[model samples]
Target: MTENTQHDVIRRNPLLEAAQEEMRKFERRENEFRRKDREERAAELQLPLAEIKVH
Candidate 1:
């Protein structure tokens, strides 16, 4: 194979895949915390619960 073709070959990386999965889980947890915090603050301010957005 030519040098460029050899360099362009795709490879599977288990470490990178695992890291990405962990990152997704971390983001989900962070979003949940932020949503809860927002809800608490809104309740304290007496704002309507419907006006608070979690998504």
Candidate 2:
């Protein structure tokens, strides 16, 4: 393929960029529920919060 054709094929057009942003937003929303802090996990599991904090 010509250089211009190859470049065109690989270009990040607006639609593709918008689609990618939407996917990122969806992933972040899903991860918000999937990911939990230590306190949240303890509360969910009905366990006492530990006094020690681990980084």
**Among these predicted structures, which one has the highest TM-score?**
1
For residues 7-41, write the lDDT of model 1, one tens digit per residue.
55433466678889999999999999998998899
Off by over 4 Å in 1: 1-12, 52-55
**Candidate 2 lDDT, 12-51, residue by residue in tens:** 5867998999999999987776656666887888875566
What is the alpha-carbon lDDT for the whole of candidate 1? Answer: 0.80
Give me the displacement of residue 41 in model 1, in angstroms.
0.3
Model 2: pairs clashing at backbone N, Cα or C within 3 Å = none
Worst 10 residues of 2 by lDDT: 46-55
Q: What is residue 45's positional error in candidate 1, in angstroms? A: 0.6
What lDDT does the true structure give each of the candidates? 0.80, 0.76
The Cα RMSD in angstroms, rounded to one decimal, for candidate 1 relative to the true structure is: 3.7
